[model samples]
Target: DVEKELEVQIGMKQEMELAMQMLEKDICDKQDVLVTFRQQLDDVQSLNHELSQKVQGSDNVIRQKNEIIARLEEKASQMNCTIKQLEQRLRQTQSSCQSAEEANYLFKQEFGEKILRLQNEVDLLTKQRSQLEMGLKDKKLSLHSDPHRINGSEQVKADQQQMADMKKELEQLREENLRLRQAGEESPSNGIHQSSRSSAEAEKERSTLERQNVICKLCEEEVSVTRLKRRCHNCQAIFCSQCAINELPLPSSIQPVCVCNPCHRVLLQQYSTTPPP
Candidate 1:
């Protein structure tokens, strides 16, 4: 019985040693798990710090972009206003140009009509002068043929009176011819007396042609428009008030509504019975 009791004691001692070794291995495994958890926590903290820095940079970029957009919008508004002002100025300039063109066209039309009328009058005067020259030649021939008939004192006296009248008419004709020549020599473009040019120079000419329907018989100059009193529409005659009173013919016995001289008798008369309103 003593041997059996000793064997039980030895078995109990071996179990106690085995239990102590298991407890030591369990403690070492728990320490290794705790170290792994701490390393994972450190990695998470580093990632969070980097993420916060990226978010801050993104916010700053957004703010700068918004400011740039605002500036661009402001500049666009200014450009739009400038464009509108330019359009308005362009429209006004076009209107002014159109008005100027219209005025120029009207002036040109009036001047052209006056120039044509003046040319016609010059042609009529030239024809009259030519006819007078023919008449003078005929008179000279008649005078030469009647030498014997004009030898008597009474006959000579009559011939002298006729000759004097003819001389006066001839002198008037020469003066008229000289005036026409002078007018022809004066350039329509510059109003200066000059030689004639070829047809090509006509393209470059700028003339201001004026009309004159009235001429002074004594001075042989154009009558002043400011001093004109009566105008004959048919003959286009402008006469001073005194000249019209003295030159107009009067009826002998019967009183006529209108009295006209020999030159204007055939023309349609427009008598001014009253002053202009």
Candidate 2:
């Protein structure tokens, strides 16, 4: 009986020990599972925080993009308004240009007639001036031949004064003709193309006048058309370079200047009598 009881007690003690070991193992496994769960929770929380920051940054970027879009829209609106204003101004300018063209055409027609009449008068006056100059030359020659002719001296003086008045009138008429012709040809209200065309016509007129009317005053060599580029600085008469080759000093000039033969001779005589101060 005592032996059986001892065996039963040992078995019971072993079983209890084994059961307690199993319970402790189960407890350790539970604690490990809990720790794993806690670690996983911590990882989840960190990931959530990072995701929150990214979302916030994304939101800020989206807001900035919206602001930029709004500003761009405002700029576009302002640009459209400016374009409208420019278009309106362009239309007004085009209309004004058309009206100006019509007015300019009418003005040219009226001034054309006036300019033609003035040109005819200038030609008549020029012929009259030549006759008067010839008459004066004849009178001067008669006086030189008969030095005692005091009676013709007063008449010569009167004729000279009349010639001077006629010359002044002729110069006035020429100026008026030039002004009327310029007005007929050129207008400030004209377009740039019109202005350029007018300038070309003026150049053509200048060339024609040079060809028809302007002859070398000194060269007298009558070969119909000679290019007259040089003008006498003293007498302002157009001449060839060979005709006015001499240089002389004048009171108005800082240096020696090219003068016509007649002007140069007069300057020489004056200098001989009274030297430059």
Candidate 3:
């Protein structure tokens, strides 16, 4: 009976040990699973951060687009007002000239020039109206071309965001070009064009001048375009890169500065102003 009792106790101990081993293994498995879950959570958080940045960028683009649209609408209204005023002026001028023979003779003499100017103004207004119409059309086309409408509903926002960014950039470029044109018309001095020299000698001279016109040797920023980018470091007044370089101290090892015909006198004045050591 004692032997049987001893045998039963031994069997119980073995079963308990086996249960303990199984419990230990289960705990280890749970720990491994927890570690994997932590890693996955970290990855998900990082992805969320990136997605947030993209979302913010998209929002900024949308805001810029709305601003551009508002500006375009304002410009359109102004053009319409100008057109009405011009038409009134033309009618009044025509009526005044019709009654007097002397006025009519002078009007006839000036009619060709006056008519040309009026036609030019009308054509400009028509073009401005057409541009606004096209911009509106582009916006509509972009809105409708969203591929997301065919797919899942979630992508619609992203597509709209992308289209808005593109339109904003286009509007900015157009506005800049318009401002440049207006500035050119107002100030003839601001209008500068690169002369296309055909001859090799002229091309060489042009190339030399072009190289000198760069603001910084390292960045290769053009002095002419530099005015639009930023003010000159030396004069605080904006000049093309070539103009800036011309003001730089010439190295004994390097050649003399290449300047445009107009800038030559300025360069001479600058040289004369330098006090001798």
Best by TM-score: 2
Report residue 150 deviation for candidate 2 (angstroms).
10
What is the alpha-carbon lDDT for the whole of candidate 1? 0.47
Please list the C-alpha lDDT of all candidates, in the order they appear: 0.47, 0.67, 0.50
Q: Which ranges of candidate 3 are over 4 A from the true structure?
A: 97-277
Candidate 1 clashing pairs, residues 3+ apart or interchain: none
* Candidate 3, run of 10 with poorest lDDT: 247-256
Compared with the true structure, what per-residue lDDT tens digits does model 2 show for residues 1-277?
9999999999999999999999999999999999999999999999999999999999999999999999999999999999999999999888887765565556545554554455456556655766777788998999999999998888889888988887898788767755654563455334424212356874675465456544578656432443444557788877654355445445554234567756765655554344212
Sort by TM-score, best first.
Answer: 2, 1, 3
True-vs-predicted CA distance for residue 130, candidate 3, Å: 69
Report residue 19 deviation for candidate 2 (angstroms). Answer: 3.9
Model 1 residue 266 CA deviation (Å) reads 38
lDDT of 3 by residue, 1-277 (tens): 9999999999999999999999999999999999999999999999999999999999999999999999999999999999999999989765554433243233324332433333334334434544555565665566577644544333444545554665565455545434433432343221222243357975675456445543543234454532222223333443443223222112221122333322434433444343322
lDDT-superior candidate, 1 or 3: 3
lDDT of 3 at 259: 31
Q: Using Cα atoms with residue i matched to residue i, what is each candidate's TM-score against the true structure?
A: 0.37, 0.54, 0.35
Q: Top lDDT: which candidate number? A: 2
**Residue-level lDDT tens digits of model 1 in 140-220:** 566677655444534445545665665566455545534433443332312222344445653332111113455643223
How far does residue 267 in candidate 2 sit from its true spot (Å)? 37
